[model samples]
Target: NLQLLTELDFAMAKGKLSLDMKAAAPALNSEGRIVLHQARHPLIKKEDVVPIDFELGINYHSLVITGPNTGGKTVTLKTCGLLTLMAMAGLHIPARSPSEVAFFDLVLADIGDEQSIEQSLSTFSSHMKEIIAITELAGPGSLVLLDELGAGTDPSEGAALAIAILNFLNQTGAYTVATTHYSELKGYAMNTEGVENASCEFDIESLQPTYKLLIGVPGVSHAFSIAQKLGLSQDIIADARQLISEESARFEQLITAIESSQKEIDDKKSEADKLQRELQEMRRTLEQEKEKIAKEKQELLAGAEAQAAEIVNKTRRQMEEIIESLEEKRAEQRLGHRLESELRGQISEVEKELSAHRHKRSTDQQPGEIEIGERYEAIDLNIEGVAKSLPDAKGQLVLEAGQISFSVAADRLRPVGKKPKAAGRRPRAGQAAGRTAASLTTERKMHATTELMLRGMRADEAIAAIDHFLDDAVLNGISPVRLIHGKGTGVLRQVTQDYLMRDSRVDSFRMGVEGEGGDGVTVAKLKL
Candidate 1:
């Protein structure tokens, strides 16, 4: 009963912790592996702390973390240790879903400043004491975290000692994570198998740590930058650089180049993703337009078919009614074959008129050129006539078809016979297809101005000038003339708006938007 109650309480507490930390329950494995993604420290302020990604124990059994002091290395170490413990205790860890952890039979940690005067132990002594114990007890199914390993000691001896200690723990089959400022240890992780390096990213310009952990890369201290930012002399910085070996300097340069290239690649990838999204959206819009246009076309075709069928049915009924009436009169006239033949001719003529309405002017009747003296047939009216005056401004021609005078658009007229020969002279070959003299005159009359700019004129002068412009625009069949009035004291705008409101020629008027010269331009639409 006690065990059951304890288990229930544990589950409830884990659920609450998961909600509070915005964490997911991590995967447990017997083969000893750990992978955490976007994992935050449980104790750190959530708003301020940046979550880190960490992986170990599969191909690489250990990882070395290197960066400047106080750059969240210690926090990262603590977070990894605590989360592992939490997972082993059946508590949900502060990490993303599908985060995996190794079920360790024993967990050991040697983190933080452990200097103690009462115990008569220095920081180095405390670290060594913990390291010895970890090396002895740690084996397969064990986890260990050591912060600033071999710190508070001599530089050369400490780095060498830290490497040896890490190697021993790794051989024991215990997954180890350690933080340090040792450049030698970085080299060790690079050349050694089953070991990896990670760096907490730092901004060069801001001289601040970005707190982003990048695995599979060694970290540099940037001691010169730190010293220079703290007001150290350039000569001192130069001397410090002189102390670094050529190999180490070259390695740092290579790392810098790699990072620069990586950043450029990332930027290009982001831009490509954006362009792909825009292209997909455009494709979707085009498909929708195609569907809409197809639907409208089908509707238009259906309407045309229905209309044609109605016209044919009405024509057939009219022919039947005429036939019936003619048959009724057959007895009075004693009609026979002649009357039937006349009736057939009359119905054929009516059918021809109705059928020809659907056809355009035939190719043979359409002449390349026609003048006042030129004779042509009207395909619609079915009459041959001489072209009188050339087309008016609207392309309508006055025709005299056997003294049946009428006016028709040029499109309705078509030439019938060949060009007549001049008296005692031959005509030029090209002149037959050339346009007439009257065509030029009519084209000139059709041309008119569509825009009028009135910037410097007075309100009355501008209004007066626009009155003539609008008259010409209406005559030439041009609507929506723009009037450019300078944005002065709203006087000119008021004058134009008032004039437009009263003018019967103007169908409507509106002010322009920014690109169209807002508040300074008025667009007036003329009546049809």
Candidate 2:
């Protein structure tokens, strides 16, 4: 049954495996450059994918891998050697595209256990035979894999012999991968000019082998995360980490910091994009207002001109009737008679009355003139310190901006100074600043932080936006304002507290208790 299970596992692994040998394959070149583009291990399950790709430096020659048991040290060696062998054999490797390889005369592998049952040869003797075969068959183009090289011997002897064998392979200029539990071999990788160390990634969260390979870094045992995952106490994990080299700890910290910084940058970019959209919306609203005001002004001016024309026509008709009546009366009367005198006196009186009416009408028709007490249309004159007042006789007129108490006559007003040539034209005047009545009714039209909080973002995100808001709020100089975050998961509230804790400008912040909106709001006090 055990044999059957093993065979089934091997078949399944083989069936799931695939390889690519096209242009898209990782950077493997003749210059001893190792590139495994999107290369995944065939033996690893799809669910537990071990994806890794790396180029052996253009100067790469050999590598020695060292890590905890089953940490993928041996697996990495096999993957590298097997892929190379497969490529040489004209077989595709599980890479994204074509793999590059140079022709080699011999391929050798010595992985897994080999115990001689006949007792005719000892372990060391058997190992020597394999080594002799390699030294004899190896050429400049040979590729070799050695598992636990010089292991199962005295520690001092094993390390010395391993180093010697590595040196020999380096001189032979053959590609090689060797794995060992000995720490001394790692030095061989580090000190040798063309040799490097590679490792499989392990997760700090799950304490499971991510099986992801990272080149240029020696593998770590990850005894702490593993131990912790296995139900060890915190004290044990802490002690284990303490025993690790400070450099390794620092390296892990650097990786986490890099990931965190990337996320933060992405968040900030999103925020900036949102702000840009808001600004665009505000501009659109302003433009619409200007258009509406212009239409209103057109309608108003048309009505005024029509009224003025009608009045002038009516006055002319009335004057003509009076003159005709007087002429008729005079014609009927005898020459130099009493009736003629009476008719002349009546005509003279009518002429005086007409003249008075004309003078009154002219004086009353004051265009663009602003009367101090009367109501006037608020015109955004687009000039600093000036606004267009009621029209008096001459043309449009401006009153000083912010002095609603007084009005300037239209004849006294002048055109505002022009902006620089490079400046774009302001929205056409005569349109009321086009804000919808609904928009102006309330100031709380989704404060910048509100949207993020509603999206269930992290506390840190809310805090950052609030920090930005506080800076702007300081500019606005709003005092004793309520922060309406709404009743959320309490994340916003906690984040608000954290922000207030750090902000020197905030004097105090209190969550609305019971009747004051409970957790829905926070009232903040700022120092100026």
Candidate 3:
């Protein structure tokens, strides 16, 4: 347990260091490929290290890297091999996320000098011994790193031997990365399948390495250019350039042109990536704004509905007070038949308005038009009745339910089965059937005068008298009824019109026109 704790402490310390270095956990790829994104060597200072992007073992099994010396080609080779070993050993690699490392049974490398003076083996001979061992041991599960393959020998023979060795490794299915300065090797990679060329960039003006790895572009040695920049005579440089064949010079020129084009392509790709990110951000912002607007719209609607409800409730309470006052007058036997009829109409209208505000009717089934003399059901009151009159301008119609006639809104009633047939016999001309004393009294009330005199009455008394008169006028279908309230101080006329305005049965009221009693009277139009 103590040993296990010690190992835990060591792991925690390593994790902290990884966080400080911004290292990412490496992903294992099963397709025999390694992809390193912005990978830097851990031993190198972070600011000084030039991160490299490298990939292999998928499109190509072998990579032949060519570049000028001290241009980071060797460092790239070492970085790939070391990172692979680190990932396989379960250590976080100094690379960005999405870095994938392939699992290899053996990580083989033949980098740097291998000369052995004690064994009497020259540089070329020593490298041959190492190459022979690699050829024997490397297989499909090996990650081989061969730096400066076929150096310290004749250029033509060495280039041929390098190509042959690379072909053998490809046959073995080993993932190989090698560095060389031979132009023949670059040509071989271009023509051969499953082989790719890569290079490190160098700045000729500064005589410094940029250390930027560019895949699919062969490297240039810059031998003549470097010598001239270092103060070598122009004649000597020209003489040296002439030693090379025209084919070789043209091949080098082609590589230089390709490098420039690759740089431009990389710049365009970066710009495209930046634009894509900005568009994505804009889309997200627009979506959020849309959601906010929808939410605010719903809130506004809810507030308006609440305000309307409060107004309805307030109006309901006022109407209830008016009904209570009429009821009190009726219980005291102070209301005549006309006033009693007005009270019932007022109660019916108020109840219907209140019921509509209280409940929302379903829209699934619609109520058909209510025709006169048709049997229908009052949905709110839950009572069946027969329509006695067609709807008025306000959609209110008279309904006779259980021998009691009352006004109801047309929307509250639904037709019941078929309309009833007219069965009652018509009275003879100038005569009526079952005429009685009560009927005669009703006829006299219906024929009441279209004018009411409130000239000498108080405001309260005139209000009550005008209410009764309007009710009778509406029952008798008399519109533009006149009220003689007089122009004395304008108090009576003001009160009269005010009462008319409040009464639902009164459509409108105004001071009488010329020859119609002028300002001394009020003319009210009742809702028939």
Candidate 4:
């Protein structure tokens, strides 16, 4: 119970810390590298601390930081060590996301002067003692932090010792971060492989450290510049600079020039990033506008269709009323065949107009080549027929359905055949024979029987015969035809009635009564 309560309390504390300090949990890996991005020391005040970017163990196993004194070099080293330890403890560190820490079996440090007067040890001796102990324990699974490495001794001897110590530790395969102001160490890092140079920036104008760590560049001590800024006499500063070697002065000037160029490049890159973000936002806005326009267009089209349908229905009703009135007058012997023929012509014209309207609204089907002699279905007319000719220059083709021919647009036809001969190709011998049979069948249809006989025939054969008979009756203007199926089990009669119900040419159908063959025959009325 105590352990559970402790874990709950720790979770709450971590959440609160993350909100207050802008801390993030680091990714842990076994890749033998530590990457700290914009990391701050946990003990430092959030507003005062300058975040530093530090990396080790990938490109270089050891880093030698060089800069002016009091320029946050030690702070950078401490932040890396502290964040690494915090990550190993499963605690969030004060850094941005994508910060990664490699696990280490040991964390060692030789920071600050540990002079012991009682033991008769000087500052340099004290530092060496601690460094010796670190060397003995550090290995590939260790993180070593050495601040002011090889300090508290003569400049030349200390630099040489620092270079030797760094080389030895690197050979041991341990990840190390050390700080120094020696120019020789900087040159060593530059010329050696698996060793990189880093610096904590110092602003001479402000006489303060920016504390921003820059990798892949060595730092300038800025001693003469800082002294001049701090009111030191020009003559004294000049004499101090004269004591330095000519090569060292030129090297420092080169470092200053490189730093200036790097700053300019960083500024341009930031501007480019801002422009990229703006372009992305504009693209998203344009996509939303396109979707909105499409939806509005669909709504307007639906409203227009509903209005068109209402107008067509009203016209059909008016035409029916006029036809009924004329029929009534004819029954009284007041009108002749002339008036009936004129009414039929008017009805055909209306049907043609209606079919054109439906074809215009059907925009989904794509236009395709109209192959000659191939069976196709007319989408608007709901009829299947053979294509008699290839599409003309205007994409119009002649289609024959039931004894009637129509010149329709290629877009109004959908092919229904498995294989169709190409346009402008001559028919093979077999296809020519098939065409001869079709012509003979058409001739037979001209003398079609007014009364159809379906007795003793299968259901499928009866339906096929009924379809062909109805087509002939419509073409010959025959009405009130008798379909004699001879009711027995009633299957043929039921099938006959069902087929007639779905045929558009069949205006009406009914079973005969009494003298008209009773229930044994079905009388059909076809549209003239």
Q: Give the whole-model CA lDDT for all candidates, comma-separated.
A: 0.79, 0.61, 0.84, 0.83
TM-score of each: 0.50, 0.40, 0.55, 0.57
lDDT per residue for candidate 4 within 127-197, as digits (tens), equals: 99999999999998888999989898999999999999999999999989999988899999999899999
lDDT tens digits by residue: candidate 3, 434-503: 1232243345443578899999998668877877777668756888788998888998888788778877
For candidate 2, the lDDT comes to 0.61
**Better by TM-score, candidate 3 or 2:** 3
lDDT digits (tens) for residues 33-97 of candidate 1: 88998899999878988988888887898889998876778888888888998898888888877
| Residue runs of model 1 more than 4 Å from their true location after superposition | 1-7, 259-528
lDDT per residue for candidate 2 within 1-528, as digits (tens), equals 999999888756544443222212233345555566656565666556565564553568787766567667677777777677666644557766544555556777777666587867666667767887887777676777888788777978988998888889878887777877666676578788888876555556766565555555666565665677789999878887789699868755654454345446645866996899899999999999998999899889999999998999899899999989866754443233435445534544554454354344345433343454333322212223444445556554545545433344453333333222335756433212222221221122123222123235555456555655664455346656566677757777775676577668789988877876678878787788
Q: Highest lDDT among the candidates is held by which one?
A: 3
Question: Which residue pairs does candidate 3 place in steric collision?
Answer: none
* lDDT score at residue 472, model 1, on the 0-100 scale: 61
Please identify model 3 stretches exceeding 4 Å from their true place. Answer: 275-528
Model 2 backbone overlap count: 25
The CA lDDT at 26 in model 2 is 37
Using lDDT, rank the candidates from best to worst. Answer: 3, 4, 1, 2
TM-score of 1: 0.50
